[model samples]
Target: MNLKLQQYINGKWVEANSGNTRTIINPFNQEVIASVPEGDESDAKAAIAAAREAFDNGEWASTPATERGAIVRKIAEFIERDKEELAHLESLDTGKTVEESRGDMDDIAGVFRYFAELADKDGGELIDSPVPNSISKVVREPVGVCGQITPWNYPLLQASWKLAPALATGNTLIIKPSEITPLTHIKVFELMEEAGVPAGVANLVLGAGDTIGAELSSNTDVDLISFTGGIVTGKKIMQAASVNVKKLALELGGKNPNVIFADADFDIAVDQALNGVFFHAGQICSAGTRLIVEESIHDKFVNALVERVKKFKLGSGFNEDTQMGPLISAEHLAKVEKYVEAGVQEGATVAVGGKRPEDPELQKGFFYLPTIFTDCTTDMSVVQDEGFGPIITVEKFRTEEEAVNLSNDSIYGLAGGVFTNDIAKAERCAAKMRMGTVWINEFNLYFPHAPWGGYKQSGIGRELGKLGMEEYTETKHIFQNLKPETLNWF
Candidate 1:
């Protein structure tokens, strides 16, 4: 049986042009498990065309908001029904633990449910009119076709962040999942059609960023582009989308900060710090890789953290006991290794795990042990760059002012965390951090209704909450006559 994965386009599973295929390998076994139709710019353009037609003249856009929400709710129901099978495929493609994939499925389902309730609720307001006999009512309408590019870190979860709101607001979409992890998304679109999404409402393409991302951003027919990826790639997409002045929503990577105060709950802080960086092998864009700890407690925190990291299971993801999985690919693993070497060369001491695990069973997999580096400074590359791996850098600060200053030093202001028992101190630090999402007592705990995005180079616009749907819509004003006759003013 050839694990031939089909691309979902125009509500059908369409094969790519030339029929060239790409293999999907199991990262743990280094064995090919599936194959996908290798897509190109032409395929991407076709998806864009399909979405454009759907948003402009098809049934998807003209439908009422309440009806659209019903279709989205059905999509959610379909996903919940097939979640087990989808989660299994996602874990197979990305090398994440089955448990983590199940969690991602839960997030995906919740996103669609939230958007189902929110679609008709976010109605436009009626503005006060100053002119006589003139009444203006504001209207929010779809921005038309949206080109959404999702990363592989959490493929299904990221898609829901864009898909639910876009469809709910009557904006059609052409989504391009990272080719490295495209299986789960393939099945997702299969379910969308199964749930009765009209033809051309949602489409999928597979390819590297150069061919697919560039094509979608530059395509004049697309009204908006929503991307989630590294800052460099996000910048390139922004420049490309400027060709037609398309609306853009970028959820870029972060060099997030996690501050530990002397009065904090030490055990919880240590655990959060480890999880903030090492979970998913630290592949999360919002990884709290930079740790700013109070000088008085830095020593104790580092020791506890190092001990905790050592206990993490370093093996293949298929093993139920394994806690950490491999990096996305061999090249990424090498790049992460280079960063660790750079840290050691720059006078930072590796308090724990600077090299790949020596487990004979895990030799074939692209795995790295949970790593921690102490005596780090803001100027160092490890502190400045997003170490998108299981690596954490610890820096000590004498005062609250210094910690906040150092946390805000980087150009990234995506997300951050502050741990302090003192309410005043906690609020002070949280207010000073230049990020969009700030955690006071915890890190990475988020409600579905909260807005998420970044500041500065971290990217533009927001995702989730009401702001997310707004990103795919435009505002208009309507004037109605309540007076008997129009009064002419000179």
Candidate 2:
């Protein structure tokens, strides 16, 4: 694949002002795939200026809502047309299986199509007028320039979450995809441009968060900042976005919990538990890394998980039989290692995997064995911290109340799952869990129609659904007097 080696700024593909580049590596084999421009604050500033100018000039904001929707829908069509290529790029860049990347491409297209259909659904609402001979209505308008920062875990998928809504609502945006995994994002930008998006309406800046991302957050010209990443970086962005009091939407990583009751279908619960954390090698923001198992079945459940994990085929994402791929990079692998060591220090017993695999075939890549810690407490750092790896900390719970409490015992409340055969008990637990999304008898399932976000430090605003589109718009209460009957009182 021929990489687009420049940044998309101000309606033109251009190089970084400093003329520097960063090597794009395929994490599975540590091979350099391409070199992309290493953008800085200046490149971000230029992109922001372009977006602001385009918004102020009404280049995109003035377009009819249905027209914008059509263009956005076209982007979805383009994604479909190029889904296979996009999936290949995504797999190569992020080290996720090609099959998983194909699924993401499908979901990404669905997200764009969802927002496209929703774009013109609500022009505004007519309000009942309280005053005589008066007209009152509430209309939604574009929020001007927006800055979107997406994470590496699902590069194009996360970008679609931000881009489709922003564009559908007539807002201009500068999207900064994770520098490590930008291949699919760049390709999607090409698709958007081909879909008839005006040049400055959507911009792409490639670089690290400290430079390019900082400008997007701190710049006063930006009206909104939507970021998906770690809590530490999310907090820093919140502080920086206060410069102009820009509207913020954040999806910080979560140490999500998966509570399995003893009464749940034994085989299904065990299967879903592994499905929750092992997908993408547990790099997901909503990964079910914390397992709260009922005490009665704790030992049995751990044994089942260990057996299945032992048989997982670890290899290249392109391999059809590979169950899981390597982590994104060596640095991330080390972080997971450190987390495992810390878990051991905190008195958590490593039930299955506590170190990298000794397989010589996997040595060239960053591979860690699927790990499970048995004697984990809620207070253990392994349970509290978002390890973002292929590790699960199993904590025992005696009662339903104890399970709920243990699941909610975290600084992050993005998402969690409850596995049970009892419908009433499942509803009860779902209602009690303090999370943005709770799954019953399932895990890691999401769609474009439903809203996604968190309860606490996980995030500030919702994405997807109608609320996602609303995030890119501002409400205006327009009141007009039909008849001139004003009292001349000062």
Candidate 3:
């Protein structure tokens, strides 16, 4: 695939100030696909300066909301026009199945369109005035320059969640895509330019998080910093953003629970359990890695899951028959291995897989066997921590309260799922779960219209829906008096 190998700043494609570059490898076969500029703090600073200048001085911020929405909608049209190529590049970069990547492209386009339609919908509101001959109103305005940092797991999809809203709301932004997976982001920036996004309204900086990401989070000129990644880095960004108290929107991820009640459709429950976690090799932030099952059907559900998991065909993302693909990198593969080892150490029994695949053909790529662990307790590290891999830790619960308790027993509360034939029971569990998103009789299903975020350490703020558009804006109240009367005593 042909890709532009430069940093996009102030509407121009340019190389890093330092002539350093990083080779991007296709995780499917470890083949070097392209080399992109390995930008540093200086590049980030330039991008930030450009965005700051654009928001503070340029016409983008002052442009009519309808015009901004039209640009955002045009970007979605461009995404649709190049969906196939974008899917292929996304698969090549992230080691996800091309089919999954295609679905993500659709969702990404939907996100842009959703924000575009929402742009002019919020024209603020008029409020009743306590004093006569006075008018009071509240309006939402752009938050100036924004900094967005997306992760490698879902590069372009995550970027759209930030980019669409930021642009639609007339905020200038410097987006730093994950170093390992920036191909699609580069393509999207090209499309954004094609959509007539003004110079410096959207900038792309490619580099490691320590340099590019650090500047985005710490730069005082930036009004908001949106991040989607691990908990450790999220906390650091939070601390750094405190320097200027920049508005933050973070999606740190979760060890989300998929609860199966005895009354649920056994076949469907088992099927969705695998679908929830195995999609994209279980790299999703809202992956249902923790299987909190009713004790009565626990063994039966585990057996069904193991049978299906064993039949999964793991291969190249481009292969139509491939059910799962490689992990993003060897480093990430090692992390998954360590988590599996930790699970075993904590006395969880590996029901199916716990080590790397022994297949010679798969050895060249970062492939791990789909693993399932039984006899897991809530206190197990595997059950509590975000594995971010294709591994499930099954924990049994005897009652409804116990199931809810087990599901809530984590520092993260991003998302959870409940499977039950009874609607009341499902609603009860969904209401009780502390997660930001709760699925009833489903899992890992999200769209552009709904708000996505977490309740606790899963991270701050919401990402989608009208609330998402609001994240890139600041609220202000205006009061005007037609007639003024001075007090006689003054």
Q: Which candidate is the best by lDDT?
A: 3
Clashing pairs in 3: none
lDDT of each structure? 0.88, 0.93, 0.93
> Candidate 2, which segments miss by more than 4 Å at Cα?
none
Tell me how many residue pairs clash in candidate 2: 0
* lDDT of model 1 at position 239: 89
After TM-score superposition, what is the CA distance of residue 363 in candidate 2 from its true location, in Å?
Answer: 1.0
My TM-score estimates for the predictions, one after another, are 0.97, 0.99, 0.99
Indicate whether candidate 2 or candidate 3 has the larger lDDT: 3
Candidate 1, residues 449-469, lDDT tens digits: the string is 999999988989999998987
Query: In candidate 3, which residue ranges exceed 4 Å CA deviation?
Result: none
lDDT of 2 by residue, 35-116 (tens): 9999999999999998988988986888988999999999999999999999999999989999999999999999999999
Worst 10 residues of 3 by lDDT: 1-10
lDDT of 2 at 11: 69
RMSD of each candidate? 1.7, 0.8, 0.8
